[model samples]
Target: MPKLSVVMISMNEEKAVGSVIDSIQEVVPDAEILIVDSSTDKTAEIATEKGAKVIRQYPPCGYGRAMELALKSASGDVIVTMDCDATYPSKDIPKLVLLIDQGYDLVNTTRVLTKPKYMPLGNFIGNRVFALCTRIRHGIKTTDVHSGMRAYKRTLIHALKWNPDGPALPVELLIKSVRHGYKFIEIPIDYYERIGNTTLNKLSSTVWTFKRIFCKEYFD
Candidate 1:
């Protein structure tokens, strides 16, 4: 079986970091857990003690920079990215990896499949609108453009270019990779309430997502 790497980005997610790592271990015991943390708390320490590699991105790096570091630093053939806040299902780790083994290049999880109760109403609507825009404009047929849980084949990472700077990286990567003809799949997953307050700046993230939807990378 291909080696698995579970990667996450954290910023003051201490409360949920340990539980998330434990859950991943239960599902994929041998998979390596790598975290790129920009926390001012115990998030990195807890993750390191739980056997995850902790790469510090202190002074509160933005979401895109942190995620980019985590993804690039992973050493597994199959890399699974998830939020450290325990909102995504750990049980789905193996399922995503299974898809990767079956020849898919990228796997995304859909949290809005049944109206996630934990997702705020504004976010829910915003996600749908952005997803629709991606489908119509870019032919990227994802129902949740910002879903944090995803699996990626490592080669796909090298096969594309990434310019991650802020929270809009997901949509940017999705648009470019799918346009580049990489095989993509999405599976339904449960979303739970988060373990800490959200650090997202909704207005800025929303604007960024829209900007990336038309980012020339999709064409060039």
Candidate 2:
């Protein structure tokens, strides 16, 4: 069996990290947890107690850069990534790993069908619009381009050659994966709102994100 590594990127997530780790631990007891945290709180300390290897990221760094650092530090053949906040069900991790073992290059978790409550309306609009853009530009129809929950095989990760190094990295991942002929699919997964503060300022970040992804996908 291929080893699975669960990687999470977070900052000041002391409130939700424990539950997220606990849930993933329940599903994949043998799976290793690697946390890349930049929290000023006790996030890293708490993560270590929960049996996760913690790597502290510096401030002024984007989520994409932190995730890149986390992924590079991972030691498993199959990697599953999610936010440090307990918005995604770690219990569904095995499902993603199973799909990967069956040979899918990338497995995306979609909350669209799951109909998670408390999700921002702006997020819904942004997700649908971005999904449409990705389909039209890359011929890949994905239910959740903004979803933080994703599983990917190590080989496919290399094939994409992604280096966005910013928050728009997930979008880059899907686009490059499709461009490289890698197989990708979406599976329904439960979603929830975060327990603590959110990193995004919806209206402002949405505009910025749209510009960033549009330039990378269409112009550049």
Candidate 3:
């Protein structure tokens, strides 16, 4: 069996961490699950109890930083990234990793196939606009930009120089990966409502994040 490292980031996700971890273990029994958490609640305790290797992220470290920390700590050939909010289905993990075995460097969950009806309108619009910008500016076609669920070869993480410590990390990863010549593949996955406290401020965060990515892509 190919070794896999599942890197998950969470913040105050006490309510949903157990279910997410349990599902992950079911799908990837041999996979190493690492939870890089910045939670104020019982997230760490629950994750540890669920058999996940837990690491506490320091103050001011956002989702991107937490994910980067987890990636650095991972020791698998394939690295899987997802949320601890339980929005992403753990059952699709193996399918995502299977793309790596088939020679794809990176795989992103489109999640549009089963779009959540409760998703905010601005978020929906932002994702569509961002996907179009990625195609027009980066010359790569993608259906989702801010989707937290993804899988990729560990090597691509190094190749892309993806070390963003802010909310712009996802777009930075996509753009830099394209610039660095990594193959991209998108898989359909279900999009569900979040289970824990949300860290996103939807409108403001999306606008600010897109401004950063757009400016970096076009002017920098």
RMSD of each: 1.1, 2.0, 2.0
Measured with C-alpha atoms, the lDDT of residue 140 in candidate 2 is 77
- What do the candidate models score in CA lDDT, each in turn? 0.89, 0.81, 0.80
- Residue 24's lDDT in candidate 1: 95
Candidate 3 local distance difference test against the native: 0.80
TM-scores of the candidates are 0.97, 0.92, 0.92
What order do you get sorting by lDDT, best first?
Answer: 1, 2, 3
Model 2 regions lying over 4 Å from their true place: 203-213, 216-220
- Per-residue error for 148 in candidate 2, Å, reads 0.6
Deviation of model 3 at 47, angstroms: 0.7
Locate the minimum summed-lDDT window of 10 residues in model 1.
211-220
Q: Could you give candidate 3's per-residue lDDT for residues 107-201 as a string of tens digits?
A: 88876543467567766777877788878876777878777888879888765565455575777776667667788888878877888668886
lDDT of 2 by residue, 8-30 (tens): 99889999998889988998999
